[model samples]
Target: MNRDKVTEDRKKLGDFGEEMAKKYLINKGYTICHEKFRCPRGEIDLIAKNQDDLVFIEVKTRRSLRFGEPFESVDIRKQKKMIKLAQYYMNYYKISQVNVRFDVVSVLLDESWDVKEIKLIENAFY
Candidate 1:
């Protein structure tokens, strides 16, 4: 396939994963505060509130484990970026004096684009 097509497909997969992640969080009693929150620096897939703590989430999706599990992609560099975005979001919204946590939701999809599994890792990083 062409580069453009590949990029588009990846984006579609990401969107689907994010939707799945959102639903999963909701089912777990998390109140979703935002989706696709973006700043000049970067974007976060989802933000939620779990009781008194505010949660910043990253959703990683994969069709196969050819590379690794989806959460494996959240390396140090990605974690740093997520921290920056979370800070930006809190500051932008004047949110303070609340506990904040980072979470990773990994989605695995089958060949037919059906969800195979969803894993949630809370407090994934500082």
Candidate 2:
């Protein structure tokens, strides 16, 4: 109800959604490299590898889409920050000769913490 409580609730919901997303990716044959990878610029929700390709995924979770879809929350500035963080991660890991892509996972949750919808957008941005 209060602002802090609302923020905490949203954070919890987002964490839950990220866990579900990680499991979903694993089921789809993606090896999760990291969760909440952070750099000075920004943070990436999930970094995964499918074969030789590295995937940078942004997970957006919401209770409902009354205002807009979860994926719509990722704006251009966020994308640029994520890209910068991904580049930093790549350099830090010394990973070369691997394909890279950006993806978005939109998660919709119900009151009972049940996932109502999970939309996976592959190659969502540059």
Candidate 3:
């Protein structure tokens, strides 16, 4: 496949994973606040509310584990970026004094694009 096609496919997969993550969170009692929150710096996959805490979430999806588990991709650098983006989001919305949490949702899909497993890691970072 060409680069464009590959990029498009990846984007589609990401969107699928995010939708699944949202549903999972909703079932677990999280309120969806935003999706694909972006700024001049970067984008956050999802922002949600879990009772008293504002949760910033990163969804990572993969069809296979050749590279590693999806959550493994969120390295320290990525964590820092998420933190900055979360701060930006809060400032943009004038949100303060609420408990904050960082979370990672890992979605693994089978060859047919069916979800194989979904894992939620709360407080994945500071």
Deviating ranges (above 4 Å) for candidate 1: none
Quote the positional error of residue 63 for candidate 1 in Å: 0.4
Q: Mind sharing the TM-score for model 1?
A: 0.99
lDDT agreement of model 3 with the native = 0.97
How does candidate 1 score on lDDT?
0.97
Name the 10 consecutive residues with the lowest summed lDDT in model 2: 61-70
The best-first sequence of candidates by TM-score reads 1, 3, 2
Residue 98 shift from truth in candidate 1, angstroms: 0.4
Where model 3 places Cα greater than 4 Å from the true spot, the runs are none
Q: Write the per-residue lDDT of candidate 2 for residues 1-126, one digit (tens) a residue.
A: 899999998799889999988888899899998999987877899999887789999999888789699999999989998889998999989988889999999999887889999899999999
- What's the true lDDT of residue 107 in model 1? 100
Model 2 misplacement above 4 A: none
